[model samples]
Target chain A: MHVSFQVQAGDFSNAGKVSSTVKGILKQLNLGPAHIKRIIVALYEAEVNVVAHSYGGTITCEVEPESVDIMVCDTGPGIPDLDLAMTEGWSTATPEVREMGFGAGMGLANIRKNTDRLAIDTGEDKPTRIHMCFDLADGATHA
Target chain B: MTLRDVVQIVDGTVLCGDDNLGREVHLGFASDLMSDVLTLLADDILLITGLSNNQAIRTAEMSDILQILFVRNKRPTKTMLDLAKEHGITIITTPYSMFRSSGLLFSKGLQPVY
Candidate 1:
């Protein structure tokens, strides 16, 4: 199965909608609870990153019987340094964003922790693309 | 601990999910950073935060946290409360600071989310 969602920039109110939807779908698929939680955590962090940093974005999920592939592409000021942006305490979020309880710079770290594999492609003037994969079989082992 | 016990310990007022007070929570995490909250692996945890925004509710929903305790007398906005209600998350507020709230709950036998 496949699902797509649009994420709006600075749309904190609707930030987790996509993750929530995907989580419900995963539950319906009878994915293990631990696997569902990991996938949702990664997806939610990615979705929030788009809302927090990008102008907007699109999230595509391709769910196979054994794995889930997720891609998030955003039109915004792309990251200048992937390594630096991946750091846990480095963030460029506005003060207002921090006030809302985000912008701690752990979004990417959390995504990395939850996903089996992650890839990132970005440029200063181009859009940011993040692809993540979660192995259902591997996740089931942790359950 | 039961959410009802938490409310009594923190002297909190239930802003939403009154029916959920009977629910049990195994751990407590206190943070204003949504990212920090996301890193928590445990479920059925109680989040104590000073932030009273929709993102806090959204983070709790995403992290599978069962209840939220807003400290320092912070109250969530109408929109935030609505979102919490929609997610079936219990929201409680206490006049205590985040430290005091967490300390109270800890003293009352709430475990850490580590």
Candidate 2:
């Protein structure tokens, strides 16, 4: 199955709706609980990043019998430094974003932790796109 | 510990999921940062946080966290409560600070998810 969602910039109120919907679908598919949890966490962080940072974005998910693929793309002032952005405690979020209990610089780290394969396409003044895949096979080891 | 015990230990009031007070939570994770909460890998975690917002409930849903204990008397908004209810996540509000609430729960045998 395939699905897509539009993410609005600064729309914190509805940030996780995409992840929630995907979760429901995955549950209905009878995916393992741990597999569903990892997908939700990665997609949620990516969704929140779009809401909290980008101008707006789109999240697309392709669920297969053996794996799930997620792509989050956003119009942005993209990351100036990929390595720095990947650092656990480094963030460029404004004070107002901090007040919302996000912008802790853990989003990407969490995404990395949860996904089986990941890639990013981004640059300053360019759109940011994050691609993540999760293995759905039973008994697969997770980080 | 059962959510009912957590409520009494922290002088809390149930804002939602009253019917689920019997659910047992084995670990307590205290943080105001939802990102930190999302990084947790354990199961049956009771999120103890002071940050009250839609994201808190959303975080719980994504993390598969079944319960949240809001400390420092931070009240959850109607949107948050509605979301919590939809997710079947129990919500509790406490007058104590995060430190106090964690300490109290720890003293009462709520293990930490380190």
Q: Of the candidates shown, which would achieve the greatest lDDT relative to the real structure?
A: 2
Q: Worst ten-residue run, lDDT, model 1 chain B?
A: B57-66
User: Highest TM-score: which candidate?
Assistant: 2
Model 2: residues with Cα > 4 Å off, grouped in runs: A139-143
DockQ metric for all predictions: 0.83, 0.89
Report the C-alpha lDDT of model 1 over A1-143, residue by residue, as the tens digit. 98999999988778888998998888888788888888898999898889888999899999888899999999968999989989989888888778877788888988999999999999797899999999887544321
Q: Classify candidate 1 by CAPRI docking class.
A: high
Residue B40 error for model 2, in Å? 0.9
TM-score of each: 0.94, 0.96
Q: What is each predicted model's overall lDDT from 0 to 1? A: 0.88, 0.91
Which parts of model 1 have CA positions greater than 4 angstroms off? A138-143
